[model samples]
Target: MTTYKAIKLIKRPEPGPVSPDIFEVTEKELPKAGSGEILIKQRQMSLDPAMFGWMSPDTESYIPPVELNTVMRSSGVGEVVESNHPDFEVGDRVMGMMGWQEYALSDGKGINKVQADVPDETVLSVFALPGLTATQGLLNVGKPKNGETLVVTGAAGSVGSIVGQIAKAEGLTVIGVVGSEEKANWIIDELGFDGAINYKTDDLRDQLTKLTPDGVDLYFENTGGPIQDLVVERMNAHGRVVVCGMIADYDKEVPSPGPSWVPVIKKRLTIQGFTMPDHFDQIPTLLQQLTPYVMSGKIKHRSHILEGLESAIEGLNMFFTGDNKGKLIVKL
Candidate 1:
């Protein structure tokens, strides 16, 4: 009762892909809820593409590296087991940097209570970081107009899937670029996307040309690779690109070049790379805009949950491998 399970980062990962040796699953003393604090017991934690950047020692990223021998940093949905804070009561479900641990203690800062009447898995998927990223980056940055062409890379992913759906809801024509034929079908057929291109196939540019005959007015760039190069080439005048992630480059020791700027200048493209931390203050506004879509099933999601904390090490690699069928989560 005095101790709880946690996954601690014993070593920083090398300049390549995620490996099992970097983390150690161990027991830690349960944290106490001090005055003006709330203690949380984690129910489910997300495995995101951004976590790949958190693991690399040499990577200078939007956030600092997870200090060695500490609990590996993560965000999760948790139940309040104890509370001394004025704002929170016992049994309240909250979300924040609960890390790869069974319990967390906070003073009601940086955490938001889940307000929707949905399952914990749904809250963790579209209501948390993934949904916010999609909503903000697409609407605030991409700014698609009705009947315009919208293209999304990593179209089968948690963020990309929602971005396409939101664009469709706004009456934009959505074309998804995915890694597999099944993923292509999932977005186009099941998700109501106008078209899809399988990036693993050699005819990427050809497919993009055919699907986007009108040219893309907005590109939601998630996986940066040849697919992105092709998408950028097909951009219309004054096209907007929302760079949310680069899962394709996460594992490479030496990162490759992105799409050239010559075309960017000719097309007058507006490209912005976004990190969720800088946009945390806007989550409330975003949730208000995004929650209804989720509630109405207009913004749908799929979760591929692994069974335990021990699976986190391998589960993280799924983001890069395209092995994950949906939003990867670790169910504790």
Candidate 2:
């Protein structure tokens, strides 16, 4: 049997406080690939805020809680080391929900054979799940129009960063909301956002009103909380909101109270929550369309790369603390 190391959650540790050692690294034998299956050696893993919700012991989400003693769920880029599948070859480069392990065996299900020539980092970063979520949500849900006003929360993150730029490319006035002035400046100055607000200090209502005098036509919400409520208040009539994620309440025992935006629904607004898997069929279209923009320098990225699997805990913590400026990736 082939041996491999994986990061597993030993228990659902209490949310409030913890030691540095949150996850345990354990070695195990790689499962043998069956017919229609493949074995992969992981290269890099995407560290996402969604992991926070998945780690909790709950039934509220569509995804079930990660059971104790199992590899932590995550997406990664890997190379096929062995395959018994007709569609795949041994040297294929792939990206999928391979969990947090050095080696993973898959049945070639829920996996995509990434273009071999694509950069390894892009496979797990901009062109992976976050990129698809951003492009699809903006196009399908947001449905932005030229000269419209668009606002994105968690603007420096993997999803929000791309959403802002894509909206800008569509000729919308893009306004970003981030946790720090540095992030705000990066989005506004570097990424071509029309304006940015530091949500940590700025009065959301006041700043938004000043930034988007026309009111918001699209709300790409990566964070849900008081910011969501504030964004709803400023939304123009018949606006659309894509609920991409809710990173704020992941660690709390009781969920933070959702925004009191129901009254604003009278304006004929559309708000929807979505997962990337629900729209996986559109990935080819997404990649074909986005790759050009990315290569042309129309799309920009900021990533925080942590070294080694041992630092995964720290990298995960950065998501919670809003410390990461862009995509948080574990370079193994």
Candidate 3:
């Protein structure tokens, strides 16, 4: 093909569901792999809550915002169709920041070869950003211990689900807070979470108190909502809180208030916020810690996939609505 389709950020998104007008779908001439570069035909791309931050006008975020009229930034799995890079070769599967396009040309700065014998969907859902985030936040930051209680918000989501499962495997009492009954059941029954609280239907304080009779020891914060304050209040002394994504307030004109620091002071808690970009250099080590759980059949994940590249525009709303069952991917 002489050209490929790509979506560019024409305008910054407002504080609500993403409007389609902010993105411009355009066709561009396909570029060849220049010297020491690789040409990748992206197979599937990941849709994450992090995209909201990337598209915003926030210049001080962990990573730079996507420049206006440039390809919307994202990560994806692709095949190296042509290559001049020494490490990458034609036909090799790879994953990296390929953006919101079908074809990407890389100088091999951030791209890495996919050596695992798993489907592309599995790679994006488990081994990519979601799994990496879970490992770094829960294992490294949370430092969960046996018999302790862990309450992870967005428990049915890409990162949260994996975090709960890893905690379960590590002998923690895993309780997940979800939005709907189906998600609650999936995390509790299928993913082996000790219990689940439906944030929309349940009394946050009551359910959390009943479920975590011993008090929570590790709090993996993925969604900052009303339940966030309740969970923090129930944390035991010396408890650790791993602050990941805050999806609940991502689209708000004014972000919601966080939990009070009184509990942190009284309980001697440690709260830390992390983003993947800061720990990208430690990917190899994180994978080593997370792989054993996957190999032992402890970690499980599902993909909520969109059909075409254009579908990504609407699929992002699923994060706010809690409509997606698991990891969100755009199959291009």
- Best-matching candidate per TM-score: 3
Give every collision pair in model 3.
none
For model 3, the local distance difference test gives 0.93
Comparing 1 with 3 on lDDT, the higher-scoring candidate is 3
Q: What is the TM-score (0 to 1) of candidate 3?
A: 0.99
Error of 2 at 74 (Å): 0.4
Q: What does each candidate score in C-alpha RMSD? A: 1.2, 1.9, 0.8
Candidate 2 accuracy as lDDT: 0.83
Q: lDDT winner among the candidates?
A: 3
Q: Give the distance in Å from residue 235's predicted Cα in candidate 2 to where it truly belongs.
A: 0.9
* lDDT, candidate 1, 136-180, per-residue tens: 999887788999999998899999999999999999999998989
- CA-lDDT, candidates in order: 0.88, 0.83, 0.93
Weakest ten-residue segment in model 1 by summed lDDT: 52-61
lDDT tens digits by residue: candidate 3, 1-332: 69999999999999999999999999999998999999999999999999999999998999999999999999999999999999998999999899999999999988878877889999999989999999999988888899999999999999999999999998999999999999999998899999999999998889999999999999999989999899889999999999999999999999999899999999999999999999988987888898888888898999998999999999999999988988999999
Q: Rank candidates by TM-score, best first.
A: 3, 1, 2
